[model samples]
Target: MKSGQLNRRVIVQRATSVSDGAGGQVREWPEIGRPWVKASLWSTGRGAGGGQSAVADVMQDNQAFVIRMRPRDIATGDRIVLDGLNYRVRAVVDPNGRRRELQVSIELEVPENA
Candidate 1:
């Protein structure tokens, strides 16, 4: 595959350390490595509440969308749009666990325009 097409965006996301409601800590990706979904770009804004907020609230030129793909549709070199930014898939994987969810790491920019 051409490396040029592998352009992507990456953001270090934080997963909350959930308590079992008792006395235990657990970290969840919520949806696993952020999935790349296509959506129209929107303006940026600020948020008021705590916890996870919408990308539009934090991104400068934000894009927003609801993902519409089967878990298997994700692959390396695919273009993903998250928070109005373009990202290229760098790595695709499924961390060993009880589920078959995939995790993808994307880069923030592409050296060459595609």
Candidate 2:
């Protein structure tokens, strides 16, 4: 991928678990940094809804994102915010295997309260 196609400014986020002050834990996403990336859909699938929070397990539409090589560590469960939507990272891989770039496999997240 060319550098020009990666025009989308994206904020990388990672989940941090902390006390909710009620003896329970809460997951908070903190912005790691902003990076430019080329986003594209890898595949789309039909989703079935079971309960309020089981939608993602039923089906998922996965996307493949290509971003400029980054120096930080990227992992699963990290998300990229684009156009105000959260694309949850399902997997991260070095596409070229030469460490020139990252290929992030993702799925659209369905809010539990929505």
| Model 1 spans with C-alpha error above 4 angstroms | 1-70, 97-99, 111-114
* Candidate that scores best on TM-score: 2
Clashing pairs in 2: none
Q: lDDT for every model?
A: 0.41, 0.65
Q: List the residue pairs that clash in candidate 1.
A: 7-88, 8-87, 8-88, 8-107, 9-87, 63-83, 63-84
Encode model 1's per-residue lDDT on 1-114: one tens digit a residue. Answer: 233433443332434578887798876433335533322223234442221133223233422222222245555555564665655554544444433434444444443655
lDDT of 2 by residue, 4-41 (tens): 86777888899999998999999999999888776654
For lDDT, the strongest prediction is 2
For residue 8, model 1's alpha carbon misses the true position, in angstroms, by 16
Q: What TM-score would every model get versus the actual structure? A: 0.35, 0.72
